[model samples]
Target: MTPPRRFRAGRFLDAAAVHAAADANPRLRRFMRTVAGHGDAGEVRARRLLEHIIRHVIDDVGDLHLGNAVARLERIAVLRERIAGILDHVLEGGTLPEGVRVEALGESFDQLRTEMRELSRPRDGIVGDAPLRLAEDAAAYADSMLREFEAGGGAAGLHSEPAAAVNDAFRAMPADRQAAVRRAAALEPQALWRAVASETEGGKRAAVADLETRLGGRLTPDELSRLRTAVDDLGVARNRGLQVSQARLAEALARIVDPELRAVVAGGDVWLTQQLALHNPEALATLWRRFRDRGGRADDGPGFRAYLRHDMVTYGRGVLGEYTAAFSLSSIELFLKGPDANVKVAGTDLVGIGHDGWVWLVDDKSHRATSVGGVSALTDNLVANLRRDAADFRDAITRLQRDDPGFTPDPRILDAISRMEDAAAEIERINRRGSAATRPARISRALEERRLRLRVTSAAGEVREITQALRDLGLAVEPTGAPVPLPPTGGR
Candidate 1:
């Protein structure tokens, strides 16, 4: 058979009726409190019992099903009966009657009645929670009863509440159900108060504090405080962000490298600071999670929103430090690829593609790249190679002019070469300045010019022009007037 279809309208009406009953009677508070502490099986059973009680309580006192409801209550009345059995067993064991059997069961009934009354009452808005006073009271009362019973009768408190609770529970039902429920509740009054109180403190505050600290101040006071109170109550609520800014920083720290890049990154505190500066909270959160989960790498750029005024150079260097040696080698490789491509030199990582290049070799942590013969050694080597290539090109051009004097090459080619040389010079100046902000424009433009030349200029012409350009641009070039040799392949 299909489970009962949830009638939204009926549920709404039923809820309203439950609210009405709780508001009108104080006994509902006791009932809810008792039911809360029940074990899973007991709680489930109690929930069913409460639902039945609520339906009966509101079922017009004269309903035809009233008699059946009373009979049903009698069938499910286990709490009182079970406690009575325990009390009898304890007496038989020759163990002095511990008040726990009395107080615990007694308070359980009290809570049941109180909760029932609270739920029965209606409020302006539907208040799912009844007052917590009864739970606290029940707990204290249960504690006292257990202690007295443990002492063997000197302090066995007379638990009048269990009988009263059962009485109240039945009384709250339709009047027709009360007599039958009363008859079925066969609880022993002597051992109803015996119960072990549970401990509440769980050392969660320190754990919460430690977690919050690691979050790098990303967690709000409200969020941290909420976690500190109870882990079970945590919710994935909107506006309640889980702070992971520090985690992102740690991630970013493991990926980037390059000194100039490090310098660019060092000026700022963290990616989160950059994010805050941009005033983009969503981007900040996304970058944080990405950094935390994927790590800080150049390829991971898609996940992290670049909001830094300095191009997140510090963050980049932190990431670079993770593979400092690898990045330095890669920098040299890039610089060796071409003389005209913009090259960025910073820390150990070299960025840029041509003559206008930025070299970044991150050594912020190791500080090795900044030292002499470190990244600077690589830079000097690159400059010297450019000089050698220039000398070779000049000699080749001189050979062509001599061997084929009739070859009056296009002056436009020479002009283009001259322009490239000029750009290279500008790039060198920018490099000396070591300012990433002022360099990209010149570097980017030079590469565009180089690309144009690469397509338009002759190979020999390009080599000749680039070498002369390098020499003119304040770099150490090979001696002039060197002899030019024929191509090794004898093919221009």
Candidate 2:
């Protein structure tokens, strides 16, 4: 028989609710009470009571013109039991018998559906209303039972379509084996994908052993290959979603004035998108306005600069919050832009060597001025920034060791690391003594030793001190002409 027609709109019941109602019926409850009263013979008495309820209470009640309702309820109860048995068997890793026909299950559902509709029809008198209400309750209970059965794979038990091959193959196995397969499939598909993607030799071996144990048998070579492919596909799909999100963020950052800043924003776009989507969606409009103002036509220079500084603080903090092991080196005000490369160097923002040979240099910046009380504030800020940069340099070395064992540090990186350490020490000494005379010279020497090129924009006044300090270090600085014009803003 075809499965019960889907209900239009009505109250639905779940398996537990249906079972509870069945057990709570007045006649069933009285029989249970009497059985328990027998003390030592309770189990035997309960079984006897159950049989009497089925034969007497249910069968005898039919003579009162409730035969259809009684019969439908009995069939529904039996079907519920069968569905439960099937689900329990599958969940336990057991398989079904080959070519099993669940047509009777479908017929039972259809009968319950029909009886429920009939019982729901309006009754003329109070006496008629009582039976009608009971029938309505039974119908609702059956609907829930049907829903639970479908969810547990009962609905797919008799499908003949090719797409249902997995279900058919599952059904053909022994009940216990079918349950094992279902349990394995249900074991967090996303987690399984990650394990397959990131597991090391030992981890992969352990994962394989665990899977085999759960499945109750060793997978054939072909089966293992197919499973791995499925997991890889899931991982690829997840990465695709991330890339799409990143692209949207990149589009948003297009109006940023500085090429170096734009690149940095792009690098962190994935993390930034997550932050905006989850916490600060309102911040997007502000960020977009800054982007739009940076288009070559606008002369909102001071406002744009202020926005950049604000973003440096807010976005920098957002990054730090997201990455537990994060440390900031320098704010954007101090970033020495590269003359030729689109990248900027500030000390270190995030440092790691990719699978590719290029070493990563990350810098975080905020608009907040470093100096508040003239030279003293400058000294304190320089010292603090140098110390943080030194720490980041050290972290980069440690990461290199972990990622590529026996990897030697590049001479340029090693020299920069040593200079950063010395700079930190000198700046700290100057800060403590409240001396301004040696501050610029010491900072200049450190910048020179690091050999960083500075990007000179048309807004040279913004970085005048930084440029002079670099010049004192004897490094040649050149402007990268006017900032490039940004494309027209696109609608989100």
Candidate 3:
């Protein structure tokens, strides 16, 4: 038989959490104070139980099935109240009829796990989720209970508002369904409060100082000031959109020079959508699930949004070998074939056909910001290579002119080479100036042209290593002094 047709969660407004909230009022607060500092073995157990309940049970694990979720929360409440009762008796300095019955208490959890296993099992044609609003409803209801409980001086309101929640849950349903639900609820007296579970913290934080650590890899050495100024919430700010400014994104993009790789980072118009689909699909799972289930993006916390940006920036790190082929302006046959035709292995970025049956190969000297210092080592080698290539081309033209009296070099090509030589000289001067620099507040203000200079280096060393492998394979490879243009930038 076909499973129930998937319905939008809005069809059923957020219902009461089938489970009630745990009360941590003044009684529990006093209990915590006594135990948290130093108390007997029983106080220690109570404190441990409260911590476990707070960390695990109330955590909102975000289950897809309502029954499994309800069971988990329902049993957690049972456990909390049981501890509350024990604490109450201990505070009164009286021996209770029943203390913490380890076996009996553990049974509630065991039952929850069993029901979760049973409910979580795959059913025929049942690729459906419970109403997403249910989790919202649970959390809201619990918060309301907490507010009311604290307002009542904590000691009171333990049993307050019990009937209202179950009643409200069924209120959205038809009269007949409401009657049936209330009849089935069979609620107990003095057992009030419940809420739904959610996923773990998704890189959200209370302070800007926290972001520096989590996002340390993505940021430049002196990027905290820009990031602090970027958003007051430290990138957790959410209203109707998960918007990361294009400027901030470009700043986070580091010193990437490749256009395709830059596109992967900046993500152009769609921003994070394309980048997530390309590299980290799982990062967008919850958001997509919400879209599928509710046809809307929930006000999911900043943690959720922050995690998304983190994922995009994390994988957006440029690949040395793959992007080397991506920037080819020639008919390069990539060794590592991918959906994108331009992707190629590292050493052979641009391997295309040359005239007279000669094979043309362009090896990328990809460097990462992590590996290279960006200014000194990069420009030193780059300046040397370009000058040598220009001189060799000039000498070759001179020799050709000697043979053919009317031999004239293409002024456009000669100008291109000369213009590049001049550019290289300017690059050298800038590199020297950058060698001894002071730390600036912002990247834009710091070394205005640092990214441009850093873009000069590409992945090297790999090609030289491949030289021995080729010689071993009897290829007798010889180095060429051909006029190659400036190489691409470093990989991740």
Most lDDT-accurate candidate: 2
What C-alpha lDDT does candidate 1 achieve relative to the native structure? 0.35
Sorted by TM-score (best first), the order is 2, 3, 1
Candidate 2 TM-score versus the reference = 0.24
The clash count of every prediction, one per candidate, is 98, 22, 13
User: Who is ahead in TM-score, 1 or 3?
Assistant: 3
lDDT of 3 at 444: 22
Tens digit of lDDT per residue, candidate 1, span 305-401? 3433233443443334333333333323332122221123332222222232432211122221211222232233433333343344456667889
Clashes of 2: 22
Taking all chains together, each candidate's TM-score versus the true structure is: 0.16, 0.24, 0.19
Candidate 3 ranges beyond 4 A from true positions: 1-235, 238-351, 360-467, 474-492
lDDT of each residue in 251-354, candidate 2, tens digit only: 55664555544444443323343334334435544564556756722344334444544555454443432132122212222222112221232233333332
Model 3, range 1-492, lDDT digits (tens) per residue?
A: 111223223223111121112222666645555654473533223433343333222223222344345555676577667656665876797664364565654665676555455555633112446423323466765565455434644322111122233334334444544332232222311111111110012212232344344454554543434334333221222210123433545554544443433443343323344344434545445444544365333443333344455433332322433354334323323222121223222222332222322222333343233232222222335456445555755787889999998988766446535643664576456555653332111222222222111122232222222333222212221222221333333111
- Model 3: ten consecutive residues of lowest lDDT: 191-200
Name the runs in model 2 displaced over 4 angstroms: 1-380, 434-438, 442-478, 486-492
Candidate 3 deviation (Cα RMSD): 29.1
